[model samples]
Target chain A: MTILRFDDWTDPVRPVKRDVIAKLPEDAGENPPVLFVPGPGHGATAFAEHWLPHAAGRGFAAYALTPRDGGKLREHVHDVVQTAASLPRQVVLVGHGEGALVVAHALGRYPARAAVLAAPVLDRWATMGTALRVNPLGAIPAVFGGRLRWSRRQLLSAGAPVEAYGRSSRLVTSRKPVPKPVGDPPALVIGSPDDRVVPRKSLDRTAARLGGAPLLFPGMGHDLMLDAAWTDPIEAILDWLTKELSAAS
Target chain B: MQDTPDIADRHDAICVIGAGAGGLVAIKNLREHGFAVDCYERETSVGGAWNWRHDRSPMYASTHLISSRPLTEFPDFPMPDDWPDYPHHTQVLSYLERYAEHFGLGAHIWFGTEVVSAVPVGDGRWDVTTRSTGGGAERVQRYAGLVVANGHNWDPAKPEIPGEFRGQVIHAAAYQDTAQLRNRKVLVIGGGNTGCDIAVEAAQQAATVWHSTRRGYWYAPKYLFGRPSDQVNDRLLRLRLPLPVRQWLYRRTVGLTVGDLTRFGLPAPDHKPYETHPIVNSQLPFYLAHGRITAVPDVTRFDGAAVELADGRRVEPDLVITATGYRARFEFLAPEILDTDADGRPDLHLHAFARKHPTLAVVGLLQGDAGVFPLAHWQSVAIARWLRLRTTDPVRAAAVQQKESTRPVGGWSRTKVVHTRRHWFEVDHVNYLRSVEGLLREMETSK
Candidate 1:
């Protein structure tokens, strides 16, 4: 009956806790706890299937936080913030798609050890503003004001965003400039060239904002986590995580 | 004549030759029509000219159907939506395998059995003699109907290039893969799809590549504005217009002119109104634009390692590929029944029944730049119905045969059929389907 299921290293016997962070194998003795925040329309299940099994295989005890009630962006953000507040070790945050933007907003409040933003959905206004130039005039306003606004929060929760979400969200949002490091944690960003749904240009801008840790693949589609070549980027994230966790220790 | 088997001992029911696209369609159609059809395929697999891995096949990496997925697909089976807009050779082969499996066609398929001779018996039946490549004893079979779906491309025709070159020379059919041509200067002779594809692939690994075409060809894209161009062309050809006028309009719309090739960084040949490749897909020009491939004039002579072009240019190439077209050879049939005119295609009636032999139906022979599956499907249906009538009512069969025999045989001329647009062929396919459908409907209604 269950369409998707994956193995998680943290708390193998008990059901996953909503607030507690899980420690990766590499983070066992003195490693930093890395929290994997789920995107809009997704849950801890997706993170388990897409990220945890692979990440745990690479020796990282990654924690995927569950979604909260009402399932709004504000509530989920509060959930993530509440979960991060209790972690004893210095936390390294990892967000995918729109969850990257939420991490960006949340990082301004709760400083993490390091951030890994995979295919981030940045500013909606600047993103859609650019798309409206090529898009037909009649569909511009509604596409920008109504669809783009609602989809960004949805995409942040869901691992994948609609095509309109990529176009309009890109038009309205400007690139978020990388802030001065409060904790000197290195951020790694990865994307695919063949991603039609999420323009590689947006990933480039996102990488530039994070001081250029971009890893681009040619034939891979929009779903980077599902790609066969995901191991390279995921390994890079673990390597960065290991170095950071060591330095923190 | 110790123990030689007499040809008369062969059993006859239905003999379908060539396991390519057309042959499979004919077999499937006849079986569906409740006829005990036995298909004789020279090759080990079904997929006609579209099949790869056959030693005699000239199919290349870029070989694909020019027809859109919708039109190219069998009426009963639609292509998968997840498949690319223009399916590749592997995809096409997989689809054919699926089609064969769905229709239970393999049990009837006689792989490695080459039809050596097909002689007509006295009572509207055929005596078919087959030889297995395994050196086994010859097997002869008799059938009530005979369908020649052997297809057009059986013999590779190489251009007459004077003097023997010391370098390696191979026909497109013999080209297995591109492993040997790495870092070597390659000369790909012929401007058709195979030549272009070879030139492109060779350019990627080879030091350099020179593509030679005797004449300029109009390169038609598989898609126009994100849709298959054949879809638009098919609609246009169905409008009752003079053949020449229709061809002209088709050329203007879908066909890429010489200037268009220049824009894509390919050299336009000096010759006018060139021939296009029958199989449509090739990524050569795309690679050419990126400086991976170079175009040259036609070859006149080969002097040891160097080759001299008709345009007075000379270049040395380590390997030469002849992408020259193929000739359809039916050696098994009698010379009278296997009649060919000036253009070399067997003289047939509307490309279905042979003019000299009304009892014999030839599917997949008449190609006009369009996909042959639909045409072959319709032809099979018509042939099946005709056979059904022949069995049910001998009097009507005789009358129809008498009427058809009175009609004058048409002359074969390549020049006449060459100017025909792809869309014109689609119109023929549609018309053939409708005619066959109408005949089947009439037969059903009367019953």
Candidate 2:
């Protein structure tokens, strides 16, 4: 439906040679591939640490993207869309935090088999306000077009001390309204009520846009894929995809 | 066709002709809308015209995309990020192959099965009779709808000259490689992209090359300002700048890049840049500048091994390749069903929905300044939405039918196109897509 995207038509994203971290099952099943997109400051390592291997272990072809540093939302979305197209089959887009925003935009272009948004920063202003209240040092720099840094306590409740990669990156603050996904792909929103980066209302709003309620994971932090209990959410996602896609086909 | 008891009853399925890019997307989009589709491709493989192996393909050895990859690829299924700006025909074929594979559309496609006829069976259904390409018994299957995407490029439009020439004359459709032009005097006719491409190839391979055109055309460069020219043009279009402004900008860019083409003995362009199907060939100008290509006026007559020009001159050429373009032809469906215009082109609503029948639609029937793939994709998606409306709310569908007739197709073109068979389906990409978006919004709101 976004065929008349003039900006995209005129200023298309240039192709950059980047690596995609992948973990394939011993015997890949007919299940759709799961492509995980990390949010700002997070590399593919965020998912490659646990979620990717776990999803692949659960009989899916799992892949993660290491998006270019300091890319805008459009560029990130283009990268995710292009990577998904290169996959053997339709993929389940699993986006974390700001990557979820990219996934939300990508859904308008890509007809994903299913979508999973983990602690998605759907409302940038609301997330910004929350960050300002709790972590002024990280949020203030981000306000002036600088990188947003996150503390280990902010990203994960319990895990090995957060890597430097866990710090927040530059944020996109475009005022354009979110585009409704094409084909209305079944979507699942996963978030933690105790997350410090994203407010609870933003999660509810995102779920509402997708015509669903967020599957809340209490006591978990902002980085669901990198959190100590990463397996819990990955299992929930795979289980939902198995049911929804089977019913769709 | 025999009415055998084995005739399949697929009332729930839609029958799509030609498993090219258009047909493949039609099948995928309809299936996305929860409609069962049965797509038939006469060729053994997919990619339609992009597949050189297909007998109906008009592809030649030097056939690279005139438009860049971003606009050329499907919006949902993009070409590879690593692909060049303008991919070659083989890469295009592989892209289509990958598209089919990724979407799992191959299962729906019936390869080597050519639809012989599609007769509407009173109701909103069609009795689609198909036969195997390798001479087999014809089989008829009943379907709820029919989509014509056989493509218009395969049917070559040979030009008419007064006298017969002794030299071997062939349509560009048949010109496959330089082997045909090597060591021979070549006369490349027409001012289309294909004509320019062949002329450039002939300059490299032939002993002498004479490019004969009826009128001079603006040969746009493939790139401008270090970016694909079409993208730059689209930016202006996206800004909704007035037609005059965009046209002025276009002329300025062309002036700076491909300065006065008449310096190479080519005539001044008879019309504005947007007034014709854009011929993007930077090499044509390069060849013309090097004196490898001699531009001649229109052909007046053919005099046994020599072609007489409009001016008082004659040139003898061993081979004549006419790239005069193609006409839209649908052999399977009755011509009346398409509601052809005075020019015999299918006068569809939005160049998609057949005015006469709600269920009958056509995809990839038009030519735009940009790539046709995205246009074709949106057209199919609109068709699926309309078909769904026809099933759910017949009243709204009827209202839509009435609205479609009031509007004209390709009305968003920047300038009045020169009246020619080639420009019949010409449209400005950004404007046309905006109109399509308008129609989609209407469909959504009405629902």
Q: Which candidate wins on TM-score?
A: 2
Model 1 agreement with the true structure over A101-196: per-residue lDDT tens digits = 666655653546688887666645444554344343523664634433322321222333333132232122324453333223467777665554
Weakest 10 consecutive residues of candidate 2 chain B by summed lDDT: B406-415
For candidate 2, write residues A152-227 as lDDT tens digits. 7778886534452346577765676788888778999999998998888999999988888999888888988777
Q: Looking at candidate 2, what is the lDDT of residue B51?
A: 96
Query: DockQ for each of the predicted structures, in order?
Result: 0.01, 0.81
Error at B316, model 2, angstroms:
1.0
Tell me the deviation in Å of residue B16 in model 1: 1.5
Q: In model 1, which regions exceed 4 Å deviation?
A: A1-249, B1-12, B238-259, B262-291, B341-344, B398-445
lDDT of 1: 0.62
Q: Model 1: per-residue lDDT, tens digit, B344-439? A: 546566557766555688887665444667567767767877777777787876676675555443221133334422212222444444444544
Superposed model 2: Cα runs more than 4 Å off: A158-166, B1-7, B341-343, B408-415, B445-447
RMSD of 1: 20.9
Q: What's the true lDDT of residue B245 in model 1? A: 75
Indicate the DockQ of the complex predicted as candidate 1. 0.01
